[model samples]
Target: MVNDSLPPNQRRFFLTIILGGLSTALAVVAGWPLFRFLSPDTGGADVEIVEIPRASVDVGGAHFLTYRGRPVVVLQKSAGEFAAFSAVCTHLGCIVKWVSDPGEFLCPCHAGRFSTDGAVLGGPPPKPLEPIPVVLAGDLLRIG
Candidate 1:
């Protein structure tokens, strides 16, 4: 029963409100997935410990694995020392590679480098790689 008899200003105000609301709703629907994809997982309650065989990773070598849908790296620094870090680079979320000769991780995307112990060495990374909890369990490496 709406009609053109309504005042022009009232009609324009209602049209603006309706269009603005529709645009906002559409934006939220489209942007929610992108926000979730770019955001880091901050909840730790669902994370579980993962075990790897000590013999599998060689000295000065790295093993890439997935923990709770995220990439992780297990580094064998020496004969008996082991460390675990999130494989995602701090700069731009690119996966890092283990470079044994120089004993560091290299991010192919932006040339960010990290030490074997997960410290930022050179390049664009603003912070060190995230260290994961690691424990030795009778020839097995326990990581979380």
Candidate 2:
């Protein structure tokens, strides 16, 4: 129970303060979930489209970039054909390195190898590297 020794006005003041504090706290508690749901999630991928110049990726070579916060590699297979793949290794989540000399992606962690099309070629990776969507629009290679 609240102390009764204080003057009436003082007690009312204290009660008002407590009531205001509780109201504010309740507002915060009730609004927290709604605020979180309406807020933009900065930690997740939010990019809608990524564009790369066609000339940036040469024929038989690779261009590396971050696609929606994941490592991605783009390769020009031919004059008008292009391919894109996630550079992350399927076995251990290591970023794969493109070796132009060997024409393969090498995961240094486990020696996992992947072909230009992201197919697992050798070593410990259980699956192919994830393929990313690519479209050629005029001079731009639209990637997602």
Residue 107 in candidate 1, Cα distance off native in Å: 0.4
Instruction: Tell me each candidate's RMSD, in Å, in order.
Output: 5.7, 6.2
Model 1's alpha-carbon lDDT is: 0.91
RMSD of 1: 5.7
Over 60-101, each residue of candidate 1 has an lDDT whose tens digit, in order, gives 899998887789999889888989999999999999999888
What clash count goes with each model? Answer: 0, 0
Q: Considering only N, C-alpha and C atoms within 3 Å, which residue pairs clash in candidate 2?
A: none
TM-scores of the candidates are 0.68, 0.71
Per-residue error at 73 for model 2, in Å? 0.6
